[model samples]
Target: MYVLEGDKSAASRELLSRFTAPYYLLHGTDGKLGTGIRLLDCGDMMITMDVPTDFEKSLLRGKPAAVHP
Candidate 1:
């Protein structure tokens, strides 16, 4: 599971630290930076963003092929 947020990093970090699922993060130019700074108390998380317009293009790359989008 993952989230796309402009701000609220601290909150995200807090939640991510306790997240029970494998997760990813997509931090974007959503005009919320300060909140993001507080969310770094975590690992197994990184940011690689695809703006909503390009979502389908990113998902077509090769990965484990058993699942369908």
Candidate 2:
């Protein structure tokens, strides 16, 4: 898996946007204890965002990612 880790900065956004294909931005929903990170898998690249607060969550709020078993 291609993991790209960074904060939500201009550089991060520019790097994340390099993937031209479709992807999903995954985040925690409060029920499950996670790493407090946001992930996006665009087939080739896996993007991750560190979101550990309510403000951060609100800032990154967008479409939900569907995880299958």
What's the CA error at residue 13 for candidate 2, in Å?
0.0
The lDDT of each candidate is 0.35, 0.35
- What residue runs in model 1 are displaced by over 4 Å at the alpha carbon? 21-69
Taking the tens digit of each residue's C-alpha lDDT, what string does model 2 give over 1-69?
122233345443444456444455433223222322222323332443432223334355763422222
For model 1, name the residue pairs that clash: 9-35, 9-36
- Give the alpha carbon lDDT tens digit for every residue of 1-69 in model 1: 234433334533343355343453333333333333334335333542212332333344542212111
Q: Which candidate is the best by TM-score?
A: 2
Q: Which stretches in model 2 have alpha-carbon errors above 4 Å?
A: 1-6, 22-69
Q: What is the C-alpha RMSD of each candidate to the true structure, in Å?
A: 10.8, 12.0
